[model samples]
Target: MAFADELKKLIGKGKQAAAQNSDKIEQAVDKAADFADKKTGGKYAQQIDKVQDAAKKAIPDK
Candidate 1:
């Protein structure tokens, strides 16, 4: 699948699982951000951080 499609699927799963598995969702998002950062060699660190923050906000730890 395309990257955008894969990301969409991941976000969908994260949203669906947030209520019962927030930690797992957070971990998945974190891993995604880490992979993105590594792939970009930290060039988009700020944007990645923003995305990570949004993910965390969307699925707060319980």
Candidate 2:
């Protein structure tokens, strides 16, 4: 589908950018997870931690 193709392209571009700026990406992930955790008052700590782990797995430190 066209939507899938476009999404793949965007993901590819993001991967390239992430490779160049892994630290910034990781920081952004941390900020976002922290924000979500704060918003939920630690109610979704496990979910946020899972998301953080997934993001770290997807975007390696390279």
Identify the candidate with maximal lDDT: 2
**Per-candidate RMSD, Å:** 8.4, 3.5
Quantify all predictions' global Cα lDDT against the true fold: 0.87, 0.91
Clashing pairs in 1: none
**Can you tell me which runs of candidate 1 are displaced by over 4 Å?**
1-16, 60-62
Q: Which pairs, if any, clash in model 2?
A: none
Instruction: Tell how far residue 14 is off in model 1, in angstroms.
Output: 9.2
TM-score, cand. 2: 0.73
Give the Å error, residue 51, model 2. 0.7
Model 2, 1-62: lDDT tens digits are: 99999999999888788888998888999999999999999999999999998997788556
Q: What's the count of clashing pairs in each model shown?
A: 0, 0
